[model samples]
Target: MEGDLERNNHILGDRWESMMSGHMTRIANEKGLDAQNFRCADCTSPIGIFYGAPRLCWYTGEYYCQNCHLMEENMIPARIIHNWDFRKHKVSKRTMVYLTQQWRDPCIQMDEVNPSGYRYIDELKKLLPLRLQLATLEPYLQTCRMLTPELLSTRLKGLHHMLGNPHIYSPHDLCLVRDGLLYNAINKLVQFGTKHVRQCALCTAKGFVCEICGKDEIIFAFDDMTSQCQQCKGVFHKRCFADRCPRCERRHNRNTPL
Candidate 1:
């Protein structure tokens, strides 16, 4: 019976849980509950990094522990990206402010359901790299806020109709609940580029039309003997990688993470 119980627990282990918010009481609120401590209730170790979990508090915007809170939506982080029309080049700087301020909102409109809830290899398969998505979305976020407030309202309505169930909506539904709500906020900002523009990621130099020019002038993205990372197909002059690997490529072993 003990072995059977262990097997059952392991099977249940992989499920996503979203209720760990303990109903959004402050960190102090759930203290000493024993039933809802932040540690792994099973192994009793610290799991306090507090990352993505499906269970979120509708009241407080907080990520919960998944291990102790099984059978609920596993909150994995996903950064939402959208088009923004802001013309400023401060993608990196603006993103920092937007994120800090936006992190406090309620998860109002998103859903944490497995995009294909019952079919994927893991229930939390929709989980994406938080930093990766955030980085990608930063370039487009600042200008999305320029959208007329009406469009934002209409978009929310469309989402509500698309995913909201009769009784409960997952915390993921809220712009606040998602990893890069700022990305989405900026996605809705006004956008202006057209006819395609390619710029040097390193120097932000613009208007290079040829790969050779890109290779010789910019000094990266060329696959010279010294400039290759196993992760990204980015080829660079040897000096580029030795100085700093371009974002496109980095060394990764079979077991290594990208």
Candidate 2:
């Protein structure tokens, strides 16, 4: 009986050690994976926290720097998945595959005017009463394509501050929460407009100049090289038309008697 008891105790001791060892190994592995997961796939650098949140690509289940994600101004990915705390599901390999396939590309192209992000069109129209005079306005609008929700908020805030007419309550005063994205988009639009808009196609009632290149020698006889918007009645260079006039296109697509 003594021998049996000693044998049982030895067996229990061995089992406990094995279990503890397994648990420790699992913990080590988990820590390693946690580090790996947050490392940027492109740069191999650990993704740093931006505004207290870790920067990561939501769809790919991988890390990416903010600059990589943005790529350029007004070119934000439509289905960019943010790793917000409010996310319904945690990103994993299986979820990433599913998301990638589901949101392969946006239904509306990037150059195409997204109706959802067109709240500023009316405001812009109000600001610029003499639309036909600014020959490059349409092209500038086209180049200033993206208006992410974050960007839209920034724009509204800027406009509110500039106008200062007490139209809306202050975000700070009201304790309203807002996304903490950098407002480079507003400046980006301003820069592009400043550089690109030199002439207007519709300013002169007679001959139209190419708003995109600022060249007056556009061959209007070729219907393909030059086209007029049905809604805004704005003429565009063929190459420019192919590129699209985002503002007029957006306005047309949104307010068309649908």
Candidate 3:
């Protein structure tokens, strides 16, 4: 009976420690942690309370000794993900290194992680449409044989990845977005791509004239005023195509072998 009691006590102690450790790791600010619980989270060193308490890392909300902390400052990923806060805060050496390495990785899913960021952040709201526009214009720009790599490089600068996939956003990209710098860059890129598509002869040849309206105006699939048929890939003016694509019906009739 005594042996079983001792084993249970050990199990309970381990569980309590694990819970506390998780809670400490997730604490966002110093206020969440007790001053009496000060210890180096990394090295498990007990810092002297009278001589000097361990430094608090803003990122992990845990205290660390001087050897572990190194007084490094970095932007907290949790703060950025939750509050859209871009301010740099004092962090531990390990946190600083981890965030620096993750800066360029497209791992943050803004919509899934913090949907409110788009609704609250005016810059993010503005940037979304610009990215969508660039995404739409990408196919036209990519398929055009006349477009030079130098011209595209000059226009797109460092945003070529956005054309392929606009949903993914890196921490570095988010920082620029928060600063209102990326918005202007994406806007300019969309404008440049749109102008090229509309003016270039090869690109214009790929545009479709609205079959319903019978207008000579060239319209691309990306145009907001146009709608596309899922079956035949026919493009028509949104107003004219209302419920169905007449071109699809006509094509079906022709292919029926009457």
Compute each candidate's TM-score over C-alphas. 0.22, 0.21, 0.73
Point to the candidate with the largest lDDT.
3
**CA shift at 232, candidate 3, in angstroms?**
7.9
lDDT of 3 at 124: 80
Cand. 1 Cα-lDDT: 0.32
Clashing pairs in 2: 135-199, 135-200, 136-199, 225-238
Residue-level lDDT tens digits of model 1 in 190-213:
111111111323222421222322
Collision count for each candidate, in order? 32, 4, 0
Q: Give the alpha carbon lDDT tens digit for every residue of 32-104 in model 3.
A: 3256355577776776566365788887677888888888888766677677777888888877776777677
Model 3 lDDT vs. the true structure?
0.76
lDDT, candidate 2, at 77 = 25
Q: Is candidate 1 or candidate 3 better by lDDT?
A: 3
- Which candidate wins on TM-score? 3
User: Once model 1 is optimally superposed onto the true structure by TM-score, how far is the C-alpha of residue 130 displaced, in angstroms?
Assistant: 8.6
Q: Distance from true position, residue 135, model 2, in Å?
A: 14
